[model samples]
Target: MSYQSDINPRHSTWRKVRHTLSIVSHEPANLLGALLLMLFSWIILAPVMSVLLNAVLVQSGDEGRTGATEGTFTAWYLLRTLTSRMSELLLWTPLLNTLAVALSTVAMALIVGVALAWLINRTDIAGRKWFATLLIVPFMLPSWTFALAWSTIFKNHAIGGQPGWLEAMGIQTPNWMAYGYFPIVTIMVLHYAPLVILIVGNALKRMDSQMEECARVLGASRGIIAFKIIIPLVRPALLSSALLIFADCIGEFALPYILGLPVHFDTLSTGLYRAISTRQSGVAAVIATVIMLMGMLTLMLDMKMLREAKRFVTLGGKGVMERRRTLGRWRTAAAALPLLFVLLGVVIPLLTLFLSTVMILPGRFTAENFTFDYWIGHNLDTVALHNGILLTPEFWHTVWNTLVIVGSASIACGVLGLLVGYAVMRCHFRWVAAFLRQLTFLPYLVPGIAFATAFLSLFAVARGPVPALYGTPLILILALIAEKMPYASRSGIAAMTQLGKEAEEAARIAGAGWFARIRRIVIPIQAAPLATGILLPFISGIKGVSLFVILATPATDVMTTWSLRLIDYNYQQAANAVVLMIALISWAGTVIIQKITGTGLADGLEK
Candidate 1:
């Protein structure tokens, strides 16, 4: 008899029920795992439900304002948003503006990313390796890393009090070009291009050369082979990169906050933020729901693409990889382009920051303008002057808090992600698996502000020992963990899938303990993925200021918060300095992890 049948008596309805209960009762790990999973799922799902329900219904006072009955189930909310008074300001115009900015951003990003990918992966560019290392600098920081850069160079006295680089040098920069759509698009593109670069770079490296050779043998020209073969093969990467940029841009906050508001430009995030602050939370939630719908639609589109993707899977291990294409005369031009983009996008911003932090005066270029006062001084001449971040004990405390929160959450998510991946991939419980998968992945659909609000509502007041964690470091950690777990766990599952079961079976044959086998074999072999899992969250956590912005207190502030404080105080120089510091720290961490683990930032999604 098989082990399953021999261990049980004849099954009856009550007996079966009792047996299942007993099995579950005996398995502490599984039971505990399920409970944690369910709790987290509830936390994520309930907020989304609140926003969705509120979006379609007539919000309190909304009906009275519109001369309709209160608490009615009319489609007025959707109608007004799509057609009535605020449609131009709140819906159609803002929507079009968002599309224009997002598309322009996408175009600029693709141009930069694809070009760099080709140079680093396919061509014998002079500094291919160094370029690869530095390419992710923009991604590790907030998308607004270069906003300060743009302002420092082209403010034109329209926003910033003093002249920027252009105006100082007798250039009368256009106000629109300096502040609104142009600067916003440029910064976003520079920030997100690295994602495309990483994905496309990996695709280029893994692409088998024989397919291109076959195309050539069929009398296809180099341009034709390149277009028909190379581009088609990497379409998955391109599409994936494009969709992420779109989803992120649609709900973006920080960039619009910095660049859009100065010129009277408004996108959904900035517009919604204003509404929430004015206690029009109902309307803000409505905007949140709109963005959520867009996210779901894009996710569906990606799924459809994956399902219908044909003629795109020519990757195989049978051919010798081709020699790198020699750039020759074009090498200088190719190398210059990526370097120039990085210089404008990364180096210029950083240089501007260095200038600002060291300068005692905002715009002067003398050594007397430099000071360590901002870095280390205590008890300066104002009520807001707490102390320098470098000198204050509080600064180190916040650093510790940030790391503790980010690290604990990441490890927890990584472990849960492995379990999730394994259950979804290997188990035959289809409906359960599907439901659970969707439940866990649902947050990717919800906007960060909406998610934060839901969490605040749930945890702000004391409900037993689950005490009010609002503005507490614990809440920040919990939120970050919940958000980043899906990514790490999916990576774990991907890595595990590539590994066969033979090793585990062989260990079992030798009568080795399950724990021993897992510790000695499974973990060692899966090291790369587990490492990748942790690395992704760390980088994301460092840049994730906006999600924490509304929720964090001074006691719980991180580097991003510090930058916001500087900006709020109108200390642009200091703000840029801090922003640069955070970006460099994140970028350095990303580069270090990639070097140590041989994994790319996009490995989780791209694979």
Candidate 2:
């Protein structure tokens, strides 16, 4: 009897272990969710924590200044950044400038974007399809493209290098026009307005026309109907777009660097860059922390707006009726508005950029002055450029690095996103699934520059078995993957949600293993979204500058960084050439992706 009691206790414990293992083994998604949770915690959560820690700790460079041991906790850095004499120059002024630029940009972008969205989606405007495609072109290119173009045309001899087109033409451009707040806001609005169009347009498209017709039946004027009904109906999208634009403007690096730097018009991003360059790691950490907090706040507000949007649902059990408003006598005028924006935003900037690349002198339009030296020449001694960008081995090498690194990261992001989606949708534990989803999205709450700063702080030195990634291409790939996780994961989740489980269930019943089911069923079914997950990141990475600026070494330079280097060298023509190439590549990539998937950039903005 004693022997049987001891054996029974042991046997019960073994059975419980076996049962738990069986459950884990049968549910591969749960296992995957757990694994992904750990991986993301290490990559995403750890870096953010590192940023916070570095902010509070006495960094190596600041130890002597703070009179503290290195790695010890100190609030001296925070105090200096916020309360010291230089705090106004270092933090407060930049914060105010960032806020000013962000608010102005959002307001202007809303006006332009909402107007275009209404014209294209709600009105019977001419070339709606063509206008829609054309409007989104500005977004595909780097945000700095317009800034460079602005400089190419309006630059003066304020800081002195090559004169701008206006100066070359004996038309002295004012510093205010060429740089500082006005140009910064104008260029940012041009760049970010397309985002507004996409988001608001999606909402407009999904809304029922019955509401508008009812408003008209009540004898409401067009203006009254628009202000009271249309605007309110799309308020959620407007709020979300405003917050997103504000966040983007807050973190913008290259635009401010190009246009604002000469005039000493500092914003938080530029200030952070200056801090890091000066090796004030603690100050930089503090600034990065602030930027991250702002981003998180924006994300929270965006989520709140999204949740509140449920209360304003336009869809019902009945089929949606979408009717475009007839422009009547104003059709041509309405069409002309979008065309005008395209000219200012796309056509003119591109033309100005192309012209600058071809001409030796900024404003000169002479045959002898125009040359292809920037594109193909071997000897360029005047500007100190050894060879044309197309002929330079460094340029080619950088292009290759961009393709390999960004491409690999994008592929990884897509695959991991799909896996994340699969695990989130299919995991056994609801809390685990929710955790994995939120963790993957945490990266989106961080700005690119701040996120790069975090990665630099965390990965500059080896942690345990991981080697130092400070100057390596591996760090760039990892950062790109993490930075882009939100887009990829969202794509993955949306695709998977639309897909029913019947096929996978049938495969499981037929004795198909998890890997086999994913390979034979899930992947094939969600190929388009999977492709979208890859291509979106690839395009964004190709045009990206802020993320790579701090992290990329000379050997690991991408096209965007290469262009920035050229600018530093005062190789204006060569820089414009590189920027043009980047824009072309991004545009072509977008076109190809849309062609293959039959999905436009605006399609993703739909709720």
Candidate 3:
């Protein structure tokens, strides 16, 4: 009987389960990975599921409209969003506009970004290093900074506040040029072009000059060499950058709110914002669902394209020779193109915003008009604003809120990311490592606005052990941490992969525990990447608007939300001042991080 039981299938299965549990109990990293896998699966999937459920169910306030009991599933919201008469205004038009803007921005940004990158990395253009450094500055600023700057220069009399510089100079800028598709696309192109440059430049930097030289030796024309050899070789980066830009533009909120709202031109993001603002939770859920789907689709396509692009590898075991094509007589002229972009995209916008803040009136170039009232004056009655931004407790509160919330979220994300990396690399369970990795990366595929809506749906009311977080700062920090997890996880994973297990093994041999090994061996060695994991998310959170806009209440207002509030009150100078301050903070933070880490923004893009 004992021999039979030892050979029984049930006995064997029980033994296997016991063995696995015993192993997991002994290996702390594997145990941690298993726990993280469960926690992250819930953290990532719950909000998305909530959003989808809310789209189909009759939410509390939506019960009357849908004629269904609250929490019961109904298709009324979907029908109203997709097939009703208001669908044109609420969904289809915005959808079409979003696609159009995303595609156009991608195309224009590719052209400009590719040109600038080629000039700097491939051709011997003058000031290559300077242009490379300066161009990334636009990306450091908020995406809406360009929109605000454009408004400062081209805003017409449509909304009726302070006329823009062009209008004030008696130019009478057309509404199309001021606040609609054109400015929105142009600003997005300028803002995202630097991203394209980084991605494509990294590809170009790795490309061998021998390929181009061989093409030329075979009597290939310059255009054919570029189109056939260079472009195809860098197709992966192009596709990656294009999809990234498209995904980002489709879900951008602040730009459209600033530049497209007055003209009644709405993208999916802005339309979703309006729905949420009006308490149309059902409708907003549908819109958020669509945006999320679009973002996921873009991510899928990016992965597919990258997989296909793997067939064309530029680097191999051979010694690589990189030769820059000399522009010769045109070097100076070629240099001027990137210089012009930096001027138009970076310098002009920042200068215009600063000037607008200092001057009492728009476009007036008098010394008397240039008082520092917007920044430092006291008791100036400007529409809804009472004091200058510096003097206002509200502004300082917003700043403190931004630092505390973003800072806490970033630190948490950084530490969590390092743990995830440690688990992934050190865990004995391959499946747990894989699941945790993929789960952490899932947030990157969801649009910020859509993700915010998901959080709103999930946390608006109490769940099992969690309290309602609708009016609290904790919600913002939680959302920011989740939203920025991909960046931190990638940084941590990359850094950890480079480190060997030899030291940890030696420490273990010395009877140092797992925590001690990590504390003494891992943390000190990976400090720079740990700092990177913290600071990158911090900078991104500080400059962010879309993610926080939906989650922020008056009590939880951050810098971006505060600036939008000032805009709503028609306090142009104050709004611009707030925006300028946000920009300076973001820029300073980025500089400080770069100095600490000894890594440029472009450094990580190569991977």
- How does each model score on TM-score? 0.85, 0.95, 0.96
Segments of candidate 1 deviating more than 4 angstroms: 1-11, 22-33, 57-80, 160-172, 211-219, 307-310, 378-383, 392-397, 419-430, 453-469, 495-531, 595-607
Model 1 lDDT per residue over 1-607, tens place: 5555554455566797897678655433344346545766656776567666666666556767656665455566666667788877876666787889988988889888898888787888877777776777677667777777777777777764556767876788898878889889988888898888887787787787777778788899999988888998888888878887887788787878877887778887777667666655456666777777887787777666666556577656656576578889888777887788778767777788777666665566777767877777667544564666577665576677777877787777776666666555544445555666777777776556656655654565676767888878888877777677667767866876787768877987898765676687877887778777887888788778656776688888877776777676666655676676667768777787878687665453232
Candidate lDDT (C-alpha), each: 0.72, 0.90, 0.90
Rank by TM-score, descending?
Answer: 3, 2, 1
Q: What is the clash count for each candidate, in the order shown? A: 2, 0, 0
| Number of clashes found in candidate 3 | 0
lDDT of 2 by residue, 526-575 (tens): 99999999998999999998889999999899999999998887888899
Alpha-carbon runs more than 4 Å astray in model 3 = 1-6, 315-318, 602-607
Q: Give lDDT tens digits, candidate 3, residues 558-596.
A: 999999998888888888889988889888889889898
Stretches off by above 4 angstroms in model 2 are 1-18, 315-319, 500-502, 505-511, 602-607
